[model samples]
Target: MSLTPSSSTAPAAADPLTPLLTELESALGSVQAALSQRDALALERHAASVQRLMTDALREGRERGRGGDLTPALRQRLAAAGAQVAAQRAALGRATAALDRAIDVLMPPEPLGLYGQSGRTLRQRSSGDVASA
Candidate 1:
């Protein structure tokens, strides 16, 4: 009797990097959410996770390439995810800059020195002395 298993009975091989890509996508989504909510803690946590996942994904991709298994679709997905992450980062930077400007306007910087070089206290003058009115 034959002992070979049929194709229907054999399990399909899974792509090693698919899970990592999915995880990276999830982390990116979390980062976006954290940014929108202005939650620094969550943003930091998710950003770190995304970095780790990206490193792992790159390693896996290289391995797959060596094995001649890397697909174009996978590459496209990775590129798209990277673009999204970059966009989110830019948006966060702009928002932080705007916030800093607003804070600066609300609370101006203090003067470094209160006295002038002539041994006189520097003060804002209400009127200036001039020859003509």
Candidate 2:
């Protein structure tokens, strides 16, 4: 037989994860956008969509008997997304801490009194009264 491509061989099927990965990428980008815009409702909605997409992707992978066996490029993209989320979270945390510090400085807490209450009595007493003693 001549060394040539066989007509009987069919083309490889497209990867099932491609669409899921694409959707996930879009959702992650939306989440980042919402974060940057400080849009709580949009952020929450996109975050939930991201979570659902991850679950669906996991289910698809497991169904295909390829649990956690993602291609290198896909894994790299996931890692980058995770790093981006982590960086955003860290920045938010730092901002919150700074705000807390600023608020504390602006409105200091009241100091505790010696008797654990304000330095005042409800009733005054005369010196010779037994209640005064």
Candidate 3:
């Protein structure tokens, strides 16, 4: 009947945020596994899920600011999860760069113009020029 949150209601309010945090951690793990396997498709899917979870978590946290404080254990777990995600992201970047280099090596750029035996650009001949048979 009161506008203020009772102790009992506080826990219930914080409950939603907990699952978001858990989902984020799980998504990070999936991302790491995908990266290890070099599965780009799976990595992209997991990354998108992680992003969604993060946005939801941030919004929930802000809304619950008036509810209560997060437990120290949860805070620590969140920090560890975030660090793991960052490390995996750096690894992904390196892997992508290596892949790009490999592709470049396999498919080199084409030359622009035709060259002569003397290494000079060949000029087009006019129809009026006669051939020395």
Candidate 4:
């Protein structure tokens, strides 16, 4: 609705959607960035337009009290939109992971390694490490 995320976020305003909306923004940005590079497109660009539209429509539906067709119609549309949102987010995640792996494959290992622990090859230990700690 508002171009600015929030009034006080002078730098980073808040969206009415709040945290979930914020996370959604972050996820979308990642997808966009990943698409910006590479010779061929391997990712999808999805906007939160559907969710925003449904949210706005739902708000309007609430204005009309009991026995309103708007509510049911909104519900049906929202159900479909929700499914799309889930699928898009899942695909974006997969694409992002694939991009990361691709980047790792493309970038040669630095002498000091990524985070500077040269001898210690970064590897994931078992879940036991968490419990042990």
Candidate 5:
């Protein structure tokens, strides 16, 4: 195997871990991009978004009936994968919720105006003119 570096993409002149960190940051950015508008913990993917992706996969596998001899093993793998997916989904929820809460705290709602006060209708500032909400 040739050890020569590829010429198309040059490496940055920084610590080795720097590139790793940058890659991680980019990955995090991508994950953040996947987040829903109202939630930082929740991801919205249309292609194949599922809390139990493996369960769905296993279901599909069984529907297809592709294998006969490996059924037991397949079921076992499916169960294990389902468990892991469940754990990961729960973890993902917690992490995303925490991120949402952090963001909420960091970007609290702007102070409410007179209309912002709960149950109060909007009125002209000095009551000299008619106002609308």
Candidate 6:
């Protein structure tokens, strides 16, 4: 065999976490977009995707003998994603509270004495006499 170096370019080995991180970032972006648009169906789908990705990541970590310990890059990405989710949750909570306040103002609840124990509003009877004595 000749000892001369070959001129052909060889592909480098890829980091196993690269694809998982990429897909996770994509799913996170989709989730954020769905939240912004208030699309429940899209949100559900993307959220499931995110959950699946997380499960896969956990499995990968275990398989790699890391026992749930991730590389710095993976940890950073996950932390950012977690912060994004938390911010989204806070925004949603604020919006829901605002809507609840508006609804309360528009449709005030009955007073304590107005509603029966069973929770239905008691109907007021007419003052007019219904029958002669």
**By TM-score, who's the top model here?**
1
Ranking by lDDT: 1, 3, 6, 2, 4, 5
Best by lDDT: 1
Native RMSD of candidate 3 (Å) = 12.2
Q: Candidate 2: where are CA atoms >4 Å away?
A: 1-14, 58-69, 113-133
- How big is the positional error of residue 4 in model 2, measured in Å on the Cα after superposition? 12
lDDT (10s digit) by residue, model 6, range 1-133: 2333332212112446558767877988898898889898998899899889867765665565465435677667666766766776787689778866775576565566766543433222311223520
The TM-scores, one per candidate, come to 0.70, 0.57, 0.65, 0.42, 0.39, 0.60
For candidate 1, give the lDDT of residue 51.
Answer: 90
State the lDDT of candidate 5 residue by residue for 25-127, as single tens digits.
3433444455434444444442134433433455554664564433464456445555644655676689767866775576455457633755233222322
After superposition, candidate 5 runs with Cα above 4 Å error:
1-56, 64-70, 114-133
* lDDT by residue (tens digit), candidate 2, 13-58: 3566667868887998898898789888998899899888877766
Model 4 RMSD, rounded to 1 decimal: 14.2
Worst 10 residues of 5 by lDDT: 121-130
lDDT of 3 at 17: 69
Model 1 ranges off by over 4 Å: 1-12, 115-133
**RMSD in order of candidates:** 11.4, 13.1, 12.2, 14.2, 15.5, 11.0
TM-score of 2: 0.57
Pick the winner on TM-score between candidates 1 and 2: 1
Q: Could you tell me how far off, in angstroms, the CA of residue 56 lies in candidate 2 after the best superposition?
A: 3.6
Error of 1 at 125 (Å): 31
Residue pairs whose backbone atoms clash in candidate 2: none
lDDT of 3 by residue, 60-114 (tens): 6656655656666666766676687788878878987887677557644435553
lDDT (C-alpha) at residue 45 in model 3: 99
In order, candidate lDDTs are 0.75, 0.65, 0.71, 0.48, 0.46, 0.66
